[model samples]
Structures are given as structure tokens and as C-alpha cells.
Target: MLNLAKIGHFFLHLWRGVRELSGDDAYVQYLKHHAAFHANAVDVAPALSRKAFFKLWQDSQWKDVRRCC
Candidate 1:
């Protein structure tokens, strides 16, 4: 099974990538053009669910999940 800490780390990386991509005009244009196609797309796990996930995450003894890499 994948560790929760690793999962959190992966999400952090994904968020960063999204932020960066959103800043690029080309990416923005692509998103605009493909808005309908990707409209239903959702993150594997969302940042909003972090709090709930973290509670379970902490219970897993992965408390250092937030430690800077």
C-alpha cells in the first residue's frame, strides 16, 4: 500500500504543477478550448479534503507528511 505521507507529497507536487500550468498562456488556451472535455475532471484527492484525510493520515503514523522535502 502507498503511504499517506507519500500520497500527500504527490498531491503537493501536482498542485504546484497545476499552478504553474495555469500561469502559461498556452496551457490556459488549451484548457479553455477543452473546457467541456475536462470539465468533469477532478483531482484524485482534493485539497479541500486534506483536513479529513489528514486525520486518518495522522492516525497512520505519518505525522511528518508536511515536512519539507
Candidate 2:
């Protein structure tokens, strides 16, 4: 029998796994990295919009793929 703490930990891990698999955290991480990368540059352009980001991501993902299983 699982205790409440065990069950809660399992659900937390499951939620995090789903977020990772779904790329839900990608944009947030991108913003963080982008901010760090350009912290002192000051001349860089703005970040990509969600639509543009997804388009670019999809394009890159498909560019080198030979077949889909």
C-alpha cells in the first residue's frame, strides 16, 4: 500500500515527465537561456513569438529526418 507522500511524489514526477515530453518547459528555458546569453550584449533582437518558435522548432526537427516510425 502506498502512503500519501509516495503517491504525491509519483504524481509530481509523472507531471514533470509529461511536461518534458510535451516541450511545455522549452519556451521557459529558452527565455532563461536567451536572457543569460544576451545579458550584456544589449544589441540582440527580441525573442521569437510562440508561433515562430514552434515553426522553427518543427522545421529543424524535420530537416534531418529520413523516415518516421
Candidate 3:
């Protein structure tokens, strides 16, 4: 039973690492942050939908127009 639990944990950690490295986990973090800090705030707008959030994230990531020579 201990070995089985270890295997399950290993897979879970592997999956989380892959999601993090691939940028697939950003939305989940964003949601958690929003829920923790802004879900009840009076002035903040509601959280962005997943599609909008990704669009905004992508835009911000590439918006600086940096060039590497």
C-alpha cells in the first residue's frame, strides 16, 4: 500500500510539474488569486473568463517587443 501511494504521488507531482513548465497552470493560479483577494472587493471587476485571461496573458507576455540580437 505504501508503494502504491508513492506511485500515485509521483504521478501527481509529475503532472503538476508539466503543467507549470507548459504555462497551462497560469489560469488556475489566477483564479486562486482572484478568489482569495478580490472575490468580495467592492471596486474590482469580476475575474476574466479563461479565454480572456489567456488572451490577456499572452498579450502581456509578448507586448514589450523585445528583440534579442
Whose lDDT is greatest here? 3
Please list the Cα RMSD from the true structure of every candidate, rounded to 1 decimal place: 16.7, 2.4, 2.8
Worst 10 residues of 3 by lDDT: 58-67
Candidate 3 structure quality by residue, lDDT tens digits, 1-69? 469988999999999999988789999999999989987788998889999999998888877865788
Q: Which runs of model 2 end up more than 4 angstroms from their true locations?
A: 1-6, 66-69
In model 3, the clashing pairs are none
Q: Put down candidate 2 lDDT per residue, 41-63, tens digits, no spaces.
A: 96799998878887777678677
Give the whole-model CA lDDT for all candidates, comma-separated: 0.57, 0.83, 0.91
Ten contiguous residues minimizing lDDT sum, candidate 1:
44-53
lDDT of 3: 0.91
- TM values, all candidates: 0.32, 0.69, 0.77
* lDDT for 62 (candidate 1): 53
* Segments of candidate 3 deviating more than 4 angstroms: 63-69
